[model samples]
Target: MSDSLKVGLPIKYALSYRHKPTADIFFPDSTYNFAPFELVSREYFPTVTNPKGSLDSAIYTLISFEVLSVQELSLPVFVRDNLDCTRVFAPIDYVRLQGTISASGEMDTMSLKKDTQVIPLSQQPNYPLIFLFIIGLSFLGVLTFWFFGTPIKRQIKLFRFKRRYDEYLRLFQRLSRATDDKKKGLENVEKAVILWKKYVERLENKPFTTFTTKEILDNLQDNRLSDALREIDATVYGGIYSKTTASSLNILQELAESLYRKHRQVLVQST
Candidate 1:
């Protein structure tokens, strides 16, 4: 038996039997039990009759799977008689097991303690980027208000002014047609004057509704405004509705359009 026996590696062993020339000898086959050691291969040799006796030998290739430090095995041969078979056993042989991996001689000096104080760090939120994003949004709002706020307000005011002016022109036209009837001439002229006063008051942000015609001429200092209001007053108080009065009413409408254009120009320049 070999002193160094590695698990799963094949071990070679020879089995021999010396019997009489006429005797029959046979080695154990697959029916025999070889526990812990598995038979891999077998080699047979021819019988040699050397006058001493007939020698029969065979080699077995075996492997052991057991982890025991020492492994023992024994094999047997059979002798055949006329009516029976006899078993002849060999002496028990042992082999020492060898490990596949070699260990370091200084294994006792190695440390095995664990580091229990190592704490996993939790992921944190990115506050700096969030704060900067908020600041950027606020700054964008301020810039939008700063750059386009006045223009947007001016556009809205201009739209409202145009709507009011359009309504005034329509009502004034209807009233002027009413002035064609002699019975309603004074009433329509008075209403037209009130409408004009109210519109101009809103347009100029002034108290034109409270102002006398003379006070209006003083503030406006326009000769066309003076002539237009005088004509309208004569129609209201004296019941006059002539071609000249019609022409003067048209002049009032033109004057109002001119004031609207001037106000629009001022609004545009402010923006």
Candidate 2:
């Protein structure tokens, strides 16, 4: 062998003979034949005996060795019969078999036979794309709720307020139509005024139901509202019925409508 040896590489050498001689061959174990290598394993296959006793179908041997150092190497193998007879001749002896190991370690390649097929692998899922799609859908849902939720809430509040205002106006009209009978008309007007005060207190978040005429005017800063309530109070409490009682009730109705319109306008502008 001419090239330098390398450590930890398995080098294999195999030999087969055509003769069916009654003998066993052994690989050399001395350092002279394998100086830089260590014997790893050996294998022998069953002899294929021919029915016609042909020498060509006989014994086969395989051996493996691992390179252990960097040094010159020479391998000599011998064949001997069971009767201690040795064959040092050309076809039986292999004394000149030699080589070196200098290449990097690599595994042997395997080639498939003709018409063999390989299975295809399945594709992997794209996780990033799926995550982005879910995020986009969530953002769209939040945006849609934010855009339409406010206007719907405001419209519902306005509808409820209109229904409540209509109820107050209907009661005022009922009182105004009863003005022909003095005691009954005064009672009806007093009830209507009390209902109006309670409704305004709820709508404006103030204590109008507990306020006197002067207190109501002072808290609201509206002279028209005060004058309208005073006229109704005089007719009911003082028993001073006037011909303009219906018009006084109309003035209270107008004042309630004005307050409703102002509140509605503020709600609309905010939305």
Candidate 3:
């Protein structure tokens, strides 16, 4: 036994015995408890046999973390029998513990000084995690645009179509109501005609704005359109406002509504 052992340091202990038994014996494995100390390693020598007896020996490496001044330990070996195993214990051993301490001896309590100052540490941002989150968000955005871009565009176009059509209807109807006034009626007619041309051009993606009434009839190839434009043109050119002017405006409005529905259906089906 050592006079004193430092904490966490390893020490070796050995045991040996001789017996005439025929059965084999096994030294302590990891399952064995070395209470006051912890096991580090184990080394065993083969049995030596003579006619008199068989000798077996084993060494255990151990360490202790306990603060107890005196620690005791004992190891055991198992002897196999026909039915079960029996444990044979070695004699007890003792070791002394030595704690770490400064050689300066005790301090004078009255002379001791203390500083109470504290420095605060600034919090740091998790830049890597922030960057990863931004990248993930950007990737998700790109994926959404890639998968749904066409549908989004179709929806925007449909919305614009409806909005523009509504605006045209509101303006044309307002001007049509004002056509009863002979003072502004002729001017209103010209404005209404221009408005219709622009609306139809946008709706059908045609050049109706530049087209003359004859050109419009030639392109549309519809007798109703020809008749309606003839009435509207009579009021526009001859400076006349009659019941036919109002009917012609209604006819133009119906044509525009029909064109709007046709184009809207095409967009819906594509979506």
Report the lDDT of model 2 for residue 84.
Answer: 73
lDDT of 2 by residue, 122-179 (tens): 9998999999999999899788778987987888888887888888788767877887
Candidate 1 residue spans exceeding 4 A from truth:
1-147
The Cα local distance difference test for each model comes to 0.84, 0.63, 0.86
Clashing pairs in 1: none
Give the Å error, residue 256, model 3. Answer: 0.9
Q: Candidate 2, 139: how far from true, in Å? A: 14
Q: Give model 3's TM-score versus the native structure.
A: 0.51
Best by lDDT: 3
- For each candidate, give its TM-score against the true structure: 0.45, 0.45, 0.51
With candidate 2 superimposed using the best TM-score fit, by how many Å does residue 110's alpha carbon deviate from the native? 64
Candidate 2 Cα lDDT to native: 0.63
Candidate 1 per-residue lDDT, tens place, 33-118, comes to 88878989889999999889999999988898999988888899999999999989988888889988667565653676767897
List candidate 2 stretches off by more than 4 Å. Answer: 1-146
| Candidate 1 lDDT for residue 262 | 91
